[model samples]
Each structure stands twice: as structure tokens, then as C-alpha cells.
Target: MSRYREFKMPDVGEGLTEAEILKWYVQPGDTVTDGQVVCEVETAKAAVELPIPYDGVVHELRFEEGTTVDVGTSIITVDVAPGSEPEEPAAPVAAAAPVDAPAEEKKPEGRQPVLVGYGVAESSTKRRPRKGTSVPEQPQAAPAGTYSAPPTAAAVQGELNGHAGTVTLDRPLAKPPVRKLAKDLGVDLTTVTPTGPDGIITREDVHAAVAPAPAAVLPEPAAEAPAPVAAGERETRIPVKGVRKAIAAAMVGSAFTAPHVTEFITLDVTRTMKLVEELKADKELAGLRVNPLLLVAKALLVAIKRNPEVNAAWDEANQEIVLKHYVNLGIAAATPRGLIVPNIKDAHDKTLPELAAALGELVSTAREGRTTPAAMQGGTVTITNVGVFGVDTGTPILNPGESAILAVGAIKLQPWVHKGKVKPRQVTTLALSFDHRLVDGELGSKVLADVAAILENPKRLITWA
Candidate 1:
């Protein structure tokens, strides 16, 4: 009956279970309007801001910064009607129904509980007796089966009054979500001891049930003290979580699961470099980012068009390979959180300038940590410009769900044979790594060769298109 409304953390992207709170824009007692941005959170792929759905005065911030909260859990509480006095809900009575009246008439309609104070009760309800009070030491039948019952045990049923709730010791008390958690974890609720208010089992209690019980031992005797060390001087442990954790798991899975075959090609990109300079001066591409990466991405797209078989995915579970006609070109970007690949949707359909603009926006969004999870999914192929890090080239690992990835090395002015004469030319190495299951050596070689050819002659971009 209170005016307090709680806002839960939502699943921002594709079945993401949790997110770490990065920053809060509002404090307690601050007024917020509907759709007002309240807090920023970082999930496995990117950082996102959450907005409040209704107007209210912030009453509480449930978690601090850097705390990872599960989706659907309340993270904030607000008072909608702040000036009005809060109304307390009717208190529950844990007592039995009248023995004279038939218990069948006292049955209450069952509803999934959201709080931890209700039990999985059926016909007869049994409430746990409160501590410190005993009934009697008088002569009775079997001492009332271990202990005397409370006087309140003979109270009315839930149906007796429309407002009162009943609790029983015969069954486990848990909310629907906690019950699901218990079921998912394979923990029997009845065996778990309740630590919640009024002797109800909580989510923590259910999780603790699955943990290995600590071994017991006698207390150790006093021992010599070791040298005192300053905090963080020896070592600091950073918990693997968020994007970094997802990256680790995905990389490990892809590395072990895929049979990778890498093909390296050192190319002369002097013409491509010149073309990039020309594009910078073009009026049609005004205010757009024009760089070698833009050209490389375009060249890769053109190469995919030439050899569409390389844009594929190996479906191990179905024992099939998926050939994608449209390319969601993934650009591997490095950010403070971790490396994320936010791909352009339908990159094969975009024009040269459109592709360049998309590439520019993708890079900027990734650097600002504002990319969405959807942008990071459904990629047919990827390009990792390790060149930006000044590395010549790397044998890049294939992204999960994608069959191939291309690594672009730094373009340096090198002495090379051009027109059969030794001359200083802009040169770079390109490495194409693909899954052997989907792309064989011949197909992989063709894709790499096409990219090299397009870069070497810059005119091929038009002829190939």
C-alpha cells in the first residue's frame, strides 16, 4: 500500500543476465521524470544507460558503483507520491482456522509469491513457533510431540479474513524467482535452512546449499607472525567479469573448437594509399572519416563478393554450414572495457561512402563505449586492424559464429620491387585466418588473393563492383 515503486534492471541486450553499474546520475531525494536517464551500466558487450519509466523522487540506490546486479532485480526505489503519508500493508497472521468450521471452506486461492515469507502449502498450514516462550510443563499427551504449540497456532485461515497471510513450517517458504533458482541449481528447498525475516528461505540460502560444506578442525595454536605487507604491494587480483569475462570464454571456446588455417600475404598498397588521399579531397565524402581501414573494409567486401563462399559459418550442432549472401561486416575495436566487434548490418548492400560512414560511426561508438549488443552480433566476417597498434600482422583467431577474420598490419614505407625496379613503396602484410571446416586452403587463398589484388591496383574497386 506504500507509494514506493521499484525499478528493476532490465535485460538490455540479447539474454544478457547481468550488468555492472558504472555510474549513477541521480542521488536520493532527487526528482526524476519519466524516461529520464538514471544510471549507466556495462554488460558483456557494451555500456548502456538506463532510464526510469515513471516520475518519482529517488528514495534509495540499491547498489553502489562497480556492483554487478542480475537482470530483473530491483536496483532503485522511488516514492511516487512523496508528500503523502505512506500506507503500510495489512500484517499477516500465522494461525490455524477454527476447528468447528470445515477446513475445505478455508482454502485460499494460491498465487506465485514474490516475497520470501510464504510457504508451498496445501491443505493444512503449520506455522513455526516463535522462540523464548513455552506453553507448559504439565502432564500432556506425548508432551505435544517435542514442544508445546503457541496460543496463536489456533488462529483463523487466510480466507477467514481477506487481508491476512498465513505461514507454515511444514513447507519451504520462497518467492517464485527464488524457487526457480533453487530448481535450476538442483537444491531441495526443504533441506535449506531459512535465514529470511520470519523464518523464510532466501535466494542466498538456496545458493549456499549447493556450496561444499566446510570441514571442521580444532582451533590452531598461536604461531609466529609473518612480516606485515602494504596493501596492493604484493599483488592485486581483479575479478574477471563483464566484457573481459565474455571475451575470455569466447576466445577459449573458438580457439579450441575451430580448426584454423591462416594464409599470409604481403602486398604493395601504394596505389590504395594514394586513393585514400584522393578520397580525403573529394567533395562528395565531406566530413567523413577517410582512412586505410575504410578502404580495407571496402576491399574485403569486394573480395567477399568475388568469393562469396568464404563468408560462411560452421554449424557443428546441425552438422551443416551456413552461407551468408549478405555480409554483417565486423570491425574488431579495442576499448577500455575490452575488445568488441560491432558489425555493420548488411555491409554488402552499402555503397562505398555509406560503408565508410558506417565504419567511422562504428569505430567512434566503440571508442566511446556506447555500442549495443545487437551491433556486436550476427557478423559473417571480421577485420581486425592490428595495424593501429603498430604491429606488422597477427594470426588472428576467428570470432565465434563467424568462419573467417582478416588481420591488417601496419603499412610502412618499405623498399620493394615495383615495375621491376627497387623503389620505396607503401607496403603492408595481410593475414586471412579462416575455419578449415568451412573454408579449405584453396577458398581461403582466393579470398586473400582478391583482397591483395584490389589493394595493389585500386582500380579493381570499380571494376570488381
Candidate 2:
């Protein structure tokens, strides 16, 4: 007679293991219609809003806000048939059978409830209770609007309270790398205070457990002395998760895995700057954003067109250089979440105006933190404009799975020899970093040279294209 249907969290981003529940849009007893957003979650890539698939009245929220729940875990339970008095939520109990009982159904991790009316699959087996630790009898269900803990919660509670010796199947909530770190440092997760969300242990927690700092006892202060600062006031710790965590892992992987070679060129882009001003005045680009970056992107496209061999990826498994005929130009955008490189797909085919529009949209979407996982994948080349920050140039790292990354420096008025005369000109520097395995020094130089040539003489964009 129970109408409770559980909703498990879906993998919002590409193969993300878990997501932190940033907020709950619906609470118990609130009605939610099909396709209505129930909650917002933050994954490793970005924040996403999840919608319920069918009409229902929220019965209970399994996890609290800020809880990092594994994908496929039930976050909410809804009663689809709220018109009638709901019976006790037997779905939770009926989901699993005792270990002593004969097999009736398979474990329901495969049911993958992404919608409203999906059945909660039954578990294949249940662990036996600990000796001398009596299992509590199931309490009678209160009327609707009350909540009950699941079996997993009950077992975990038993282990934590007066049954430390009990053997349970539950593993400690730490990442594999963190587990390895704890093992290496001789720290037991059971003794560490988890600072991460939803009872999960973090690297800092393990480090603290292994090498705890002795509390600094301050002497009583004098009347004129400033009050002794608390530990929180001295420093702050931000959990490195979500987009920032993903970025760090990627940078480390790319830096160690690939052999990078960087080449720099200082060029006078006075012509390119003049072209930008002209483009702004032209009626064709009336509403679109016209800036140096736009011209820079066009020059890169022209360079890539001339030196097609530079657009490639190194496949270590197959021992081959995968040369791509198309170009997915990644533009690095710094967002509050983190640095994400979402590329313009098939950029080689887009005209200058179209490229400008795509670039405009990409920047706006990234600034608003709405860039999707798809937009950031399958990039062949990337450009990082550290120039906007007034930096000269950097040996930028190649984006993973891509062959090259171009770094553009700030443009300033500097003395330069033009037409055999030393005069102030618009000058900027460019650094090209490429996968040495895929692109040799000669090929890398050609690509960098072509780009510099196009920028120095904006007419090359017409000739090359």
C-alpha cells in the first residue's frame, strides 16, 4: 500500500563519482510536478539543477544540504499517490533480504532511478548482526510527514555507538588516494575528524591525524594588548573540491605525462590592433564584441590552416600521432568555480564574425558558470590570454588530450624599429607550448611563426584563409 518512490542522484557530469548537494529546492510535504527542479548540486565540473521526472509529493530528503552523496544514492523519496493516506515506507525494508533468506532479486544499484515511478530494486543479501548487539525492532510508522532512517544508517549508528568491535561491511568514507595517503602516514581513518562534507574524510584530515600540532597556549593579555587571535582568525582552509579539484588533478597529470616544449616570439601587432579598431567601426560587426582577442583567435585559425600538421594529439596506448583535420579551439576562462577551457567546435569553418559570436557566447557562459561538460571536451588546440591581466607571457601547459596551447601577453607601447626608424609601436609577446612528442621543434616553430606573421600583417588572414 506504500506509494513511496525513491529518487537516486544521477551522474550529472561526465563520470563524476559524487556531487555535493548545494541546496534543496523542495522539502518534505512539498508537491513537485514532472520536470520540475527539485534540487541544485555542485559537481567537479559545474553546478547543475536536477529535475524530478514525474509528479509527486516529497516524502523525505535522505541527505542534508552540503552533503556529498555518491552517484546512484537515493537523495529523496517521494510519494506519487498523495491523494490517499500513505502507508509505511516498506520500500526501504523490502529493498533487501536477510543473508539467511533465499535469493529473490538482485541488488538494485542497476535500477538507476532517474525518473519518478521507478521501483527500488531489492538487495541480494544483508549482513548478519553482531553477536551480543541486539538488533532494534522496527518502530511503527508514524503518520505521513515523519521520517525514518534507512538500514545502512541504522547499522552505521550501531558501529559508532557502543559497538566499536562490531564487523560491518561499510568502508570508511575517504577517496582512494586519501586512503593511500592515510596508509602511508600510519593514520587510521576511524580516529580522524572528517572536515569534508557529508562525513567524508579529506587529505587535510588525514595529515592532521598523523601529525597534529600542539595547541599554542597564549598567556593572559595585558590591558593594552590586542586580544589573542583564535586559530580560525589566523588562517582559513578551503576544501579543494569541485572545479578547482578537477583542475589541479588535470594539471598534474598533463605536466607529468607529456613532454612540453615552449617557443616564444615577440611581434609588433600594431597592424592587428588597427584592424580591431577598423572592425569595430564596420557595420557588419555592429553588435558583436570586437577586441584584440577576437583578432588573435582569427590569426591562430589562419596559422592552423597553413600548418595543418600542428593540430594533433599523442596517443600513448596506440603509439601514434592522431592528426585532426578539424579544429576545436579552446579558450581558457577563469570562473569563480575554477579555470575551465570550453572550446569553439569546428572553429575552422566559422567566419570571423561567427567566431566572434562563438567566442562572445563562450566567455559569457563561462562567466555565468553555465558551461556544460560537453563544451569542454574534444579540444584539439587551446589559447590562454594571460594578457588581459597585464602579464608578459607564460610557458602555458597543453590541455590534456590536446597537442598545443598558445599564450598571449599584454600589448604595450614600446620603442621599436619600423621602416628603419626607432619609434614607439604596439608590441606584445607570444609563447607556444606544444607536445614535443607530437610536434617537433621545427613544426612548433612554423606554427608559432605563422601566427606571428598573420598578426603582424593582418592581410595574411585574407591570403592564408
Candidate 3:
């Protein structure tokens, strides 16, 4: 007798509606424990590894890697019976006959996993296998706990041996983009050495191996494939189905749903900058970064004390505007994965040094995409420093739940009229945008003006206004 249970993707975050599958750890037919990591999922802020909720054999994979699925959707099915076999052949087999598949069950790329998301009714298009259809010999990836592969062919082979399954070994281990790069350079990946952890091949390794080639060998005659043609003559198009797709949807939702207004103010920022320099010279703050944004954040916090409405939000469902006294200050950061806004909890209560440390930790975690769901939620206000990119200032979109966002422009040398003479001073711009429905012109201007005042005169932050 076989007892079967479906493992639905749980809401990893508060009120999370859905998640996109990034990759799978186990295939259908594999035995899995109740708490073993089964797959990686990307939410609004970070990529999280999901643990299987039941101890069982993977009877069937309900969704494919790189698909977006709604929360509470079954991602994998398992059989509790001891002797249960995983659904079918584990190898990449030919497309199977439909077995009571869902009406919306699509076979994009002829893959079995379901794409997770809202309003995306159709499956994504199919993904073509690279030049070799055969799995790398000793398919199981590097042993558990081993570093990922180095960027090279031999390293890739080593990683394949560690995989759970057998690899055909004839194919290259690099991703589609890397493969294209190799083909364009006429560099056979099998001959290149991998430098990635656990013997995996990395893009940098490929690029490094490529540059020395031309210098090492004389250029081929004009009759040979021109360098232009040698570089992949055709373009590769990757389907936007997983994290990217989810990001697109979220950006759109945040962009159009909220009506936004922006206000900018320029400040000398001399005293605050001086404070940061002094802090950098202190022994206690050594090894920690000191930036102008810390002062700007402190200024914003002080201003929030004078004007609480700036940190509030509007709740349209109940026809009410809710005001949050506590501040969950979100810092918008750009990472390799994408732009993520993770906030510091109750930032208003932390001391100046503590706030600096918190900001440092928050940015580092968000950039690595390791910020937990708990740390990312419950935000009341946000700040984005476009100044770091060396820009003066620009309007910033409000984070979905919060009512206002402040953009800090670059602090640079600018001539300004002070007391009586024009002199070179460190100046920057601050742009504030708020929810017009909840914040009227008066409140919005007052809040923005207050923040600007604190920056213009850092001493104002010394006392309550």
C-alpha cells in the first residue's frame, strides 16, 4: 500500500503569495527526508532554500526549475511508503505521455516543472540543450560540502562525478552563456581548466583563458572564419521565467499602483561629513565603513520624530490611512542578482554607532541575497542613495507597503553662497516622494523640509525640534 502526499510550497514570508523555483536539489524518484533541502526559491528580496516537509520518496516533480508558482502550490509529490519508487526514470528521458496533467499544465521546453507566478497562465517556451545531449560522465555533482567547481573542463568533470546521478561526460559543464562564449572564441571547453569551487567552470576563468590565445598564436589568415563571424554569429535569447520574471512583475506592480511625488533639496553637509571623518579615525569604529549615508539616515530619523506621517502608509482596502509610529527604515541596494530593499527593524531606537553598524550589516546581507524574510518585512519608510553611483539626484519610487521614499544624491564639491561669499562646499541633493492620497502638500513639504534642514545644519540633530 502506498500513502502519497503532495509537498506544497509554503508561504516563506508573511503573506507571501508566490515564489519562483531557481533550481532543484532532488529529482523525482529520489529518497528524501522530512527536512532535507529540496529546492531553491526566489522571493521578493532573496533566494531561499526550501526544506521538504515530509519524509518520503520523490514520487513526481510537479514543477520545473525556473518556473514561478503561487504560494501553497504543490511543487513535488512524495510517497510515504518505504518501498515507494520515485515517479519514473531519473535520466533526462524523452517527453512522456500526458498523465492526467492539469488543464493549465504546460510543457514549455518539454520540461516537467511548473512555472510559479500570478497571471502567467502559459508555460514558458522550451530550452534547447547545448551542443551535447549526453550528460557529463559521472553526472552527480561535486560531493556534498565540496566547493563549487573551478572554471575549467577537468574541474567540471570532477564536479559531475560528485553529482547524485551519472553524467555522460561528453558535454561541457558551463552554462548556456558560457558555452556561447566558448564557441565564439573557438576554445574547446574540454581543454580549458576550471577555477570555480568544487571544480565548476566560471565565466572569469573562461575569459582569462581566452585572452592569452591570440597572443599565444599568430592570427589566422583572412580566408579563415573572420574574428567577427568566429564570435557567435547568432544571438542567444534566454527566456525570462523565474527570478527575472518575478522581479518584472513586482517592479510593474510597485511602479503603476502607487501615485508618486518627488521633492529635492541641496545641503552643504559639511558638519555631518566631518563627523564621519572623525568616526573613521576612532579606534572602535575601525574596520567598519563610514559613509555620508549614515548621517543622512540619522537626519531622516530625526526628522521623522518631528513628522511621523512621512513614515506612514495608506490602506485602501478599508478606506483608511494607517500611521505607523515605529520606523522600519528600508535601504535600497543594487546587487548582482537584482535591486532589493531590506530594512533595519526599529531603526529609530538604535544609537548613532549602532545605526552605522546596522546599515553596514543590512547592505552586506541584502547584496549577498542572504537577508531572511523576517528582516525584510515591516518597513514604514525607505532611502535610496543614487549618489553612490556618482549622480546628483533623482526621484525614487516608493516601496510597495510604505508611503514615502527619499533619494540621496552624490555629495560632491559645489560652489555655494554662504553667509556672504561663494565658496566651494560639499553639497548633495535629497529627493523625497510620498503617497499623494495619504500625504497632502503641507505634510509632504514639511517632512521634506525638515530632513533638508537637518542636513543643512547638522547641529539641529543634536536637539529635538
lDDT of each: 0.75, 0.75, 0.65
Ranked by lDDT, the better of candidates 2 and 3 is 2
- In candidate 1, the residue pairs with backbone N, CA or C atoms under 3 Å apart (3 or more residues apart, or in different chains) clash, namely 96-155, 126-168, 126-169
- TM-score preference between candidates 2 and 3, better one: 2
The residue ranges of model 3 lying beyond 4 angstroms of the native Cα positions read 82-251, 283-287
My TM-score estimates for the predictions, one after another, are 0.67, 0.70, 0.64
**lDDT of predicted model 3:** 0.65
List residue ranges in candidate 2 displaced over 4 A.
83-117, 120-232
What are the per-residue Cα lDDT tens digits for candidate 3 across 213-304? 21111111122233444465596455664335556876677779878888878888876788788889988777775788888898889888
Write down the lDDT that model 1 would get. 0.75
Q: State the lDDT at 324 in candidate 2.
A: 97
- What local lDDT does model 2 show for residue 109? 19
Error of 3 at 392 (Å): 1.2
The alpha-carbon lDDT assigned to residue 134 of candidate 2 equals 56
lDDT of 2 by residue, 16-56 (tens): 89888888999999999755778888887767777675567
Q: How well is each residue in 1-465 modelled by candidate 1, as lDDT tens digits?
A: 556777777766557899888789999999987557788777786666676755679999999999999987899988766787765432232333333448774443322333311112222333333355442222121110111122122233332442234433434655543554565577888999888753457768987899632111112112325556688797646689888899999999999999999999999999999999999999989889999998899999999999999999988889999899899999998877778898999999998889889988988777765676657879989999999889999999999999999999999999999889999999999999999988999999999999999999989999998
